[model samples]
Target: MKLLFCVYLSVLFFSLFSCQNDKRVENENSLSIQREKSKLVVEYRILSNVKYLEDRNCIEKLASCKNPKAEVRFLFPKNISELGLDTAYQEDSYFIHQLGVFNKPIFNEDENYRIYVMTFDYMVSLVVFEDKRTKNRTFTITGKAKGIFWINSSYWIVGNDCHMGCSMSIERIKDPKLLKPTKEQNLDSLRKQLQRLPYEEKMKIVRQEGDELLFSANDTLYNGIGKKLSGFIPYQNSMILVFEQYKSNKYRFIQVNEDKSVEHIDSLVNGKFDTRQFSEDDMITILPKNQSLISLCQTIFKIENDTLFVYSLR
Candidate 1:
């Protein structure tokens, strides 16, 4: 009887332990699936193709010129319409489109030549250029784009310059079912959360004659009307806000408002610039300081020299 009772108790104990383990495993699996489903999906398409210039010397000269370090470099004739693809160039703004893979020249001529390159993933064309004069001067302009795309899928399109440098913009191929918060929504939520704090806590964040609110990490209080916040700085505790504050006239003030509204409060030197709504994190702002231009995340703002900078405990 004693041996039978022992076996029954042991079995019951094991059964309960197994049930708990199974529940934990199931929860973990559910979380993993949710994470996977929330990821954004993107697709790319190319839209147009054409051959514009045909001069062999022009083509060889342009191609042989060292590729610019920047992405989306543009070389335009002083008289762009002289290139002869007047209609296409006009429609696409001097034939400026997204840059893509370049193929070796298929043919060359003294007056005209042809080289193949992918303008976008979808549109591949052979461009032909001819010069009437021996001095065929062209201007090259280059810039970069920064954005996000899907890892597993090709989200770039041809016909327009799409991906440049570290920047890539993606269009959704399929609706992303994830519930990510927008800037406004996140700001509102944070505001509500902050409102729930004691008035003393809120008062600690007030700065610049009560025009701005700040949250600090090291118990320092910063105050200014045009103070800047660092771009999209994530909080470490997931409860605190991490940002950079403006120090002088050289910076712009970026604020994540109580309502989750992000804006640029431009420097007084820039003529009392108001804040503009930005939806994404890829945007950057350039500020002209004394002699050099400083580039920083759009989240920071410049303030008056007299305003005191404050920091507070999160």
Candidate 2:
């Protein structure tokens, strides 16, 4: 009787252990599947219906579209005075009046920077400066869509009477590889992780409080038009709110602590003070106005080993 009882207990113990192991494995697999599905969904949503224009390939494709309404027309080709327009056209010698879906060379020589045309349902636009300065010059072409919508048709109308005679062309090229969202994605992930933590724990990292003194001031510091807060960089126990106080000038950095207090860091005289990042030995700041700085306008911020690095946006 004793031996039978011992055997029964051992079998029951093994059975329970096996079931627990199976449950653990199933849960892990479920989590893994969920993560993969989330990633695929985000990638598809971000990249769908997006086309890239590189080199001079799309120019011919744009010009060959048979859509009569989508035709590229040069509205004013004779002279600027004849058009009687009141828009600022800087660089009068080499200005583009109007462009449709056709691609063309923007600068004097092909310094790897090429412009492409894109048309949407509501507007026809151009994606210019795709070559070397791809990030900075990737601007949207916004205007009313005139003609037909056909498969692979890009068209643009040129403005007549411009300094340089307007022209349009197209070519075929492969799409650019999917670009990983480096900083933005990482920052969003960090914020999500931080938000998951308990409220008390999050407060320990960064506290939020209002400053009535700063809000009440009506001085030039806050009086400039188009002044708005853009973003911030949070460091060890502090955060910096980047703002555009003036429409023409670069962004200004205002540092804030965990207690919600804020202060302005002095602008660097010769050095540009665009973005702020903390370093063990010293803090690295990016300034846009520095003429000697090579990528003055295109800087990215990254953190490594608790040290922050600032990159210019040129």
Candidate 3:
């Protein structure tokens, strides 16, 4: 009888302890969780497209249609009142995707600038806005796409034009290979386009390319315009490359000799090579501007479809 009584007491005590543990667990479960709101307000965002590239970013080929869009975004917080960024916005259209600040202010504004490459696909640019505000601003370069970015601190483009193809990977600017330009592919396309145009239009594009190849605001002649250039002059002296800023109605050719003296020929029409009426065909071959010198002081030129047989005497 004593043993049975002890056993019953132990069982009753153990049950009470188990009940208390269960009640403690229930109380903990009933407690509410404390939460804190995030203080980040996105200021703006940028987006772009990416395409598959090969041949060291030189040769371009369509890889069964695997091109996708990529993006670089700028995020700002809400607390800065003097900087009136009222909202953030994003939109996707058939050809482009637009991302920017939306007026729905959420978190405290931050002055710190952050850039993110938010997409996995190879990033490419359909078109880039020449934002004057960002022209002088410097950006710290980081992330997977190093030299792949189109814009520099001074707003110079250091990547492929995407005309031929762009390398999915890019080396740091310090590398010698950086900014070499996939010239064969890019220039070939440009050359073909220029050939179909009239003489005046061709000159215009050449000048435009000169401006595009500028390294900085003050650079003079780092342009790729000279790529198609060759020596000219049917006489003893070699003919130097010439140029004219393309306009709707007029153009000029510049020739230089060993002495660095400039000879501005007005038109390919024997004398007034640079100055011509808009109506004239100017069947001038502007590129491959070469002249053959058969003898000392005697050079031969096939000009304007042999309409002008130019000869030189020393």
Top candidate by TM-score = 2
Compared with the true structure, what per-residue lDDT tens digits does model 1 show for residues 148-263?
11212211111111111011111111112111212232322333454365534433322112111111111112233323322222111111111233444233333322222333
User: Candidate 2's residue-wise lDDT over 54-105, tens digit each?
Assistant: 2211112223355532322211122222223222321221212123323232
lDDT for each of the candidates?
Answer: 0.22, 0.25, 0.21
Tens-place lDDT digits, model 3, residues 39-92: 211111111121111111211122223333222221111221123322132111
Write the candidate numbers in order of decreasing TM-score.
Answer: 2, 3, 1
TM-score for each of the candidates: 0.15, 0.22, 0.17
User: Cα RMSD for candidate 1?
Assistant: 26.9
Off by over 4 Å in 3: 1-235, 240-242, 266-290, 293-314
Model 3 is weakest, by summed lDDT over 10 consecutive residues, at: 278-287
- What's each prediction's clash count? 48, 32, 29
Alpha-carbon runs more than 4 Å astray in model 2 = 1-221, 224-226, 268-298, 303-309
